[model samples]
Target: MKIYIEDIAKYEGQTITLQAWLYNKRSSGKLHFLQLRDGTGEIQAVVFKGNVSDEVFELSDKITQESSVEVTGTVKKHDRSKIGYEIDATDVKVIGESVDYPITPKEHGTHFLMEHRHLWLRSLRQKAILRIRHRIIKSVRDFFDNKGFTLVDAPIFTPNACEGTTNLFKVDYFDENAYLTQSGQLYMEAAAMAVGKAYCFGPTFRAEKSKTRRHLTEFWMVEPEVAFFDIYDDMDLAEEFVEYIVQEVVKHNREDLEVLERDISKLENIKRPFPRISYDEAIEILKKKGNDTEWGADFGGDEETLISEEFDKPVMIHHYPMAIKAFYMKQEGDKAACVDMIAPEGYGEIIGGGQREEDIEKLKAKIKEQGLPEEVFNWYLDVRRYGSCKHAGFGLGIERTVAWICGLHHVRETIPFPRLMDRLKP
Candidate 1:
């Protein structure tokens, strides 16, 4: 019967057929050691020359790296194998042949690997990263689902920008221009008014021209919004949300973490009650670290890193300057009631959210002050006019969280087929 490599351990002592690819091959005078990988996992298959027909042995010798084949063999418990299982192959059938694959076992440059990203995903490292990414997404959905948050899907094509037009991707939409959604927080707010607690998870776009490791032209975000919640409630939820997702990934993807060589201890320390410091306190910490930062100045990547280094876990900086924050954020005097969760180990902000302004007049004036077309936000203003209560929400960057969990250097590796500023093919 055809089976996957991940479940081979369950069929021990029984003959099973696995449709796999030859991940690697090494042969002795009497036996051929073939490393095979199917999508689920990898296992070592030993083909004894004396036991199998000469034709089968010859077929094993002719198989090349990444060649698809059906390996009929008896599963055995092998404690020394990487996957804790091995197969004694009695026959080998090549389904397809692969010759001189561009991505070999040896390392290739970033540009070359990216050019061949379609094939580069076959490597174990990439597989492990993507597996963890899947786990992160699952945990995110589960966390919200269990918390009574309804799944609300936001529109991809928006008539206007959520924040500003400078960083939005404007596209021709039939008769007029429409921009790709940059964040689902605005829609989540409307959903919150309807369902009490709501969330939206999907792709987001940014047209900023940045070449930094943290920048990506397209990425995914999971935003949660709740009615009758204030800024402090938002911070509490953010703290619990971050802690849960981190621990969930660590719990379920331990093997993947091991494959990535991530420091499990670092992630284990990601508990709730994360350090919450006001923007003023963060400025003090940065100043102590010899940063030339001053009050009311927005923190850049370098300043964020310096501030986050003060704590071992994620640090939440709240009460940012009103002038720098989005107009939707509620303001107290000169500070907006917003927060940014900066990840440890130099990973910058992974979440940005806060109490949304619910006052209709204030919201309208803020929208006009930001040079936004008030008519475009009439429906949003109606949210306040019809029935509006205190509400808050936050948007978490999925790629940055994955990169931090996997201890990756760039956000590009966190997602499959990442869209960047310059590269687009494959």
Candidate 2:
């Protein structure tokens, strides 16, 4: 019977054949130990000369790393293995040969590994990171799904920018100018009016000329918009949403976390009631930490780090200066009802949004003041024109959140293939 390593425990003590790749191997005279991996998981298959025929033993010894093979063995419970199971091989058959795989056990430079990202994913650490990323994505869908949020997909190509034109990738669309969607918030807001709550989960592009650890030329974002939601309601939802995802990851992805050497205690401390402060309060904290920060100045990576350090959990900074915020946020005198959720340990802001302006006049005036294409926003303004209620939403960066949860240094490893400002191949 054919079986997967991940489900080997269900067939323990039963003989089964595993179609796998030779992840690695070693031989000690009469015994050949083989590390086998299918897509689901990896396992150790011990081959004894007395159990298998000479042809099987010779094939096992001759096979190279990543060579495809069929390993027939009896499953045995293991106390030390990460998967909690091992295989006692009775036969081995090589289906394909791999000659001198470029990525071996030896260390390689970051650039070299990136250049070979297609093959680099076969490594144990990369696999662990990707696995945890899978769990995070699933957690996102489940959290919103249970809360009755509709999964509304937004367009990738837009006639105008959602955030701004400065960091947008303008492209020729049949002679008419177009740009990649930077955020799905605008479309999601419209969807929220139709449904009570709505969300969009997909890739978002930003033609940003940035080389920072937090920046990605193209990344995935999950934006949730809700009708009849105020700034305080939005903040409350953000905190609960963040706490749910973090706890889900911690509860389900413990083994992957161990593989990444993440500090589990830190993740466990990501419980609810995250600290919520105002923009003025955040500036005060920054100034007390020796930063020459002044009012109305937007927070960057360094400033976000300083503010987040004040708490062990994620911190929400709301009521940003109106000048620095987007045009659609509800105005509160000199401040806009906007919020940014900064993660602890210097991960920076993972969630950004707040209550949107319900006044059509204010939306149109802000669009004109920002010098945006007024014609393109006519549809957006229509949302406020007809039966508009107080609405709010937030967008969370998947790559950055994964990096923070896994304690990764860069955002590149969070995705299967990272598209950065410079590197984009394999």
Candidate 3:
């Protein structure tokens, strides 16, 4: 019977055929040990000299790394094996041979590996990270779907920038100039009013020149917008949302986490009511820690790292200066009524959200103050003029969140294909 590596445990002590690729191979005199992977999982296939025909042994000897082969062997439990199962091969069929594979067991430079990312994804580490990413995406949809948030997809080509005009990737829409969307928050707000609660999960583009480990020119974001939800409610929702993703990844992707060598304890400690502090308080903490960050200045990567180090779980920093925030954020006298959630262990900010401006005149004034084209925002202003309520939402960077969960140092590895400041190709 034909079986997969992952299902080998069920057919223990029974001969089965596995059509897989030779991941790696080593031989000792007359015995050969072939590492085979079939995408689902990997297993060790052993070929004994006297037990198999000369043709089978000869075929096994000629098998190179990453060669496609059909292996017929008896499955057996081997506690010594990394995957806890192995196959004693009685027959071997060479389907296809791959020679001169670029990626080897030895270490390679980051640029070299990234340049060969198409082939590099077949590596074990990349496989684990991609699996974790899949689980994260599934958990995101499940969490929002269970909460009754309609999946409203926002457009990729937007008329105006939601974050800022400077970091927009300009494109020509017919005769008019259009820009790639920085966020779906504005459209999601409109959807929320129409559907009560709405979320958009799609790619967002930015033309930032930053080459930091956290910055990506193109990345996926999941934004949830809810009408009648206050800033505090938004923070609470953020905490719950983050905790849910972390816990789900931990529970479902435990083996992948083990493969990545991530410390599961850190993820387990993530709970609700995450450490909450005001932006002023964060600045003070940074000052006490001898950082040079000033009160109204936007926090940089290093500043965010310093602040996140204070808490074991994700931390919430609220009420930033109005001058530094987006123009449409609801203002509380002198400050923007918004919040930024910083992930633990120097993951930086994974979420940014706040209450949106509900007053039509104040929204118009802020839009004008930000020097945004009023004609473009006329549709947004219609939300307030029609029947805007206390609305709140947040955008979670999918790559950053996956990196944090997988305990990765760079966000580039979290996505299958990454678009960075200096990287646009495979």
Q: Per-prediction count of colliding residue pairs?
A: 0, 0, 0
Better of 2 and 3 by lDDT: 3
Worst 10 residues of 2 by lDDT: 160-169
In candidate 1, which residue pairs get closer than 3 Å at backbone N, Cα or C atoms, i.e. clash? none
> Which segments of candidate 1 are over 4 A away from where they belong?
none
Q: In candidate 3, how many Å is residue 83 off?
A: 2.7
Residue lDDT tens for model 1, 183-247: 98888889999999999999999999999999899999999999999999999999999999999
Candidate 2 TM-score, C-alpha based: 0.97
Superposed model 3: Cα runs more than 4 Å off: none
Q: What shift in Å separates residue 347 of candidate 2 from its native position after superposition?
A: 0.6
lDDT of 2 by residue, 166-254 (tens): 58888899989888899999999899999989999999998889998998999999999999999999999998998999999899889
Residue 191 in model 1: lDDT: 94
lDDT of 2 at 194: 97
lDDT for position 75 in model 1: 95
In model 3, how large is the Cα lDDT of residue 340? Answer: 97
Q: Model 3 over residues 93-162: C-alpha lDDT tens digits?
A: 9899898999988999999999999999999889999999999899999999999999999999998887
